[model samples]
Target: MQVDALTLSKFQGAAEPNERLPMKVLGQDDFLQLLVEQMRNQDPLAPVQDTEFIAQMAQFTSLEQSRQMSDDMKLLRAQASFQQGVDLLNKEVTVQVGEEEPPITGTATELEMVDGEPKLLINGVFYALQDVIHVKAMDGSNESQSKE
Candidate 1:
């Protein structure tokens, strides 16, 4: 989510090394470079264990899989939210457009398609699903409020 060009540029400098996360994507080449650096700087007597390297690779794989799953879940959640909003049409809505409090007396009308997306149309005005602040039933009951 965070990309910095200056941080990436510093990676090309041999005199200074980055002390934080590198802005550029770390690929196989970067991994090989890091491995070489670690081998050169490792203790001469006590070296890194093979198990440690295997464990690190396993951890990296797990982290990548988790990130992919998290991204998929986010997309699914967004789709579900959109579907829920679209389904709210025909349900009375009470939204404050400009503070006039006119209440735009009308039942949930058909959803209008704009730019390939559905939007709720109430009282001849099309409103985005995200803009609907409140929904009221047409039965005129104060306690019949439902949250979408």
Candidate 2:
């Protein structure tokens, strides 16, 4: 498309214009603003084509839907993480606290919420999900080994 010099100048070289992905990668609001500006400052002798305007509106709708889908996926991910934490309750696991501290092994007795983080309680001690290095089934293996 052969864009006029005046429209290009307004989009790019405007006074106090932002050099960010202002027009090239437009969001919903940016696309709407561009459409509004095109309508407002169009040449009187040659107005914007009807088909062109409709196409721009369709593009805006697609952009809005994609943004909505992104938000929904984020929400779903958070919910899944929380559910995984809840499932750890009463399950025996090996937890590696840090470099200085030794790994702790015990059944996950409960889930504790400490400052928005999910903590697993093992014998009155609190540990985050990352601390859980491995999960082992409590099938009397440790008890039988202790008898040796």
Off by over 4 Å in 1: 1-47, 97-130, 136-148
Best candidate according to TM-score: 2
Residue 95 C-alpha lDDT in model 1: 52
Clash-forming residue pairs, model 1: none
- In model 2, the worst 10-residue window by lDDT is 139-148
Residue by residue across 11-130, what tens digits does model 2's lDDT show?
786554345344556577767788899999999999989999998788778878998999999778667766767877767867887778877788988886665567888878888877
Please give, for residues 1-148, the per-residue lDDT of candidate 1 as tens digits.
4547666666766334445755566655666687778878989899998787788678767877887899999778667766866666667776555555644545667776565455677788886665566666556554344432
Which residues of candidate 2, in runs, are more than 4 Å off? 1-30, 99-101, 112-117, 123-126, 137-148
The 10 consecutive residues of candidate 1 with the worst lDDT sum are 139-148
Count clashing pairs, candidate 2: 0
